[model samples]
Target chain A: MSNQELDVLRSKVDEMNGQLLQLINERAELVQEIGRIKEKQGVNRYDPVRERSMLNNLLEKNDGPFERSTVEHIFKEIFKAGLELQEDDHRKALLV
Target chain B: MSNQELDVLRSKVDEMNGQLLQLINERAELVQEIGRIKEKQGVNRYDPVRERSMLNNLLEKNDGPFERSTVEHIFKEIFKAGLELQEDDHRKALLV
Candidate 1:
């Protein structure tokens, strides 16, 4: 009974992970789109002010099984990943 | 015109960020639930094989401006964060 219960919960986690994958990729595409606009306008792709505000906003919205700190940590990683996505082709080529 | 375009894109990004924030919290809740069930069964909360399998599955789903490594990297950070969410209360309390 216990093993079966674990399997059910684990599958639900798997489903959520897939949903997360879709959302992260969707967010990535938006980040890339923003990067393109910034590039064309000769503006920096990453704006720390924008990042700080977004983080603050997310923290405010957080009501969680996870703490505010945990949410902040994960979102910051996501933000960093998105910013890094906008780097120059040469750098990306080197990394890949 | 360029500034206006940026505003639109930035707003979209903000909306997406909000959505991501909600989804991350939801996923965290599921993780905690799974932790509860595992505890009841006297099973360890973290299963690295399951983690690796999820990573492989995410990599397969990757079709992107972000490289495979980048997806893997971001997902690994997320996975680590989720796993930490299941850690002992003493460790979490100390961190908090």
Candidate 2:
């Protein structure tokens, strides 16, 4: 019974991983689009005020088994990923 | 010029936020599915070994500006969210 149980959950986790991969890629695409616009406008890649507000808004809306601090931290990393994408695009634009 | 640049980036951020919201909800849906399966199978909601493996897999695949530790931390919170959903499902089954 325990073996079957573990197998079932593992399968589910694998499936969740795939869904997460897709969503993250979708997010990356949007990040790239935003990065293009940022490059065209000659704007700073990281916007601290906007990021702070986004984190605050997410924290306010959080109803969670996950704590607000955890969300804040994870989201900062996510935002960093977006910034990195923007930086990569900026670098490419410079090369061209 | 600076004001226009900030305004443009803010609009993009807003769009990204909407995309992120959709992705998180999609993740939550998968978590609920796994939770229902766990409830039916009478399994422990938290699986440390599997969670560890998932984090490790993600870390291994990460080619990022986001550090491995950051991914590990975020994933743990995401995993916690999954566990909470399972716990909630377990509780509902008990009440039924």
Candidate 3:
């Protein structure tokens, strides 16, 4: 491929990165909201059963060149980040 | 919060998920292109230096409720998935 072609692909990747960042932030906000509700109900933030089910559902829906394990690992990272965001928000709420 | 509000947040989360899925797929396509180029150049696909630099740049830019480690972990998962996608594409090219 030419330099021009490579540049074009890189630009597209950058655009996707921007979109992913925005969506991840939005997901964090939603996770914080869920955390608030969970705290109010005196429930634990991490639910292993729910996480397992969610991963199973996602993997089932995935039609990919990417393997199921890759998808699972990525989602697990997302899940962990969401959980931490919720916890941080909860801590801030407590301080306030 | 009302049931309606919870529903609203959940719906927003679902919408964000849809966006994330699209962006991730787009990223994967770009990754595959890069893979093809690397294969032609006879270069190793995995670059530890690049991966380290990427994580450092992202963490430096993170103004987050999420910790540095959380961001690092998430990016690592994305990187792994991207790498795997590239390998699979490379293998297919070899067969064809």
> Which candidate's TM-score is highest?
1
2 or 3: which has the higher lDDT? 3
Give lDDT tens digits, candidate 2, residues A1-96: 745765675676666665554455555566676667766777766779978888887777666544566567657767776677678678887898
Worst 10 residues of 3 chain B by lDDT: B14-23
Q: Is candidate 1 or candidate 2 better by DockQ?
A: 1
What is the C-alpha DockQ of each candidate?
A: 0.68, 0.19, 0.52
lDDT of 3 by residue, B1-96 (tens): 545776687667765665666667668878888788878778898989866866776677666656678777777788788998898888888899
Q: Which lDDT tens digits does candidate 1 get at residues A1-96?
A: 867876787788777777777878888888887787777677877788999999899888888766888788888888888888888542664586
Q: Write down the DockQ of candidate 2.
A: 0.19
- Candidate 1 chain B has its poorest 10 consecutive residues by lDDT at B87-96
Candidate 2 regions off by >4 Å?
Answer: B1-96
Chain B, candidate 2: TM?
Answer: 0.84
Between prediction 1 and prediction 3, the one with superior DockQ is 1
Clash numbers, per candidate: 0, 0, 0
Residue A51's C-alpha lDDT in candidate 2? Answer: 80
TM-score for the A chain of candidate 2: 0.87
Error of 3 at B65 (Å): 3.0
Error of 2 at B48 (Å): 8.1
- Cα lDDT tens digits, model 2, B3-92, are 576567566666656555445555566667666766667766677887888887777776554456655655676677667766777788
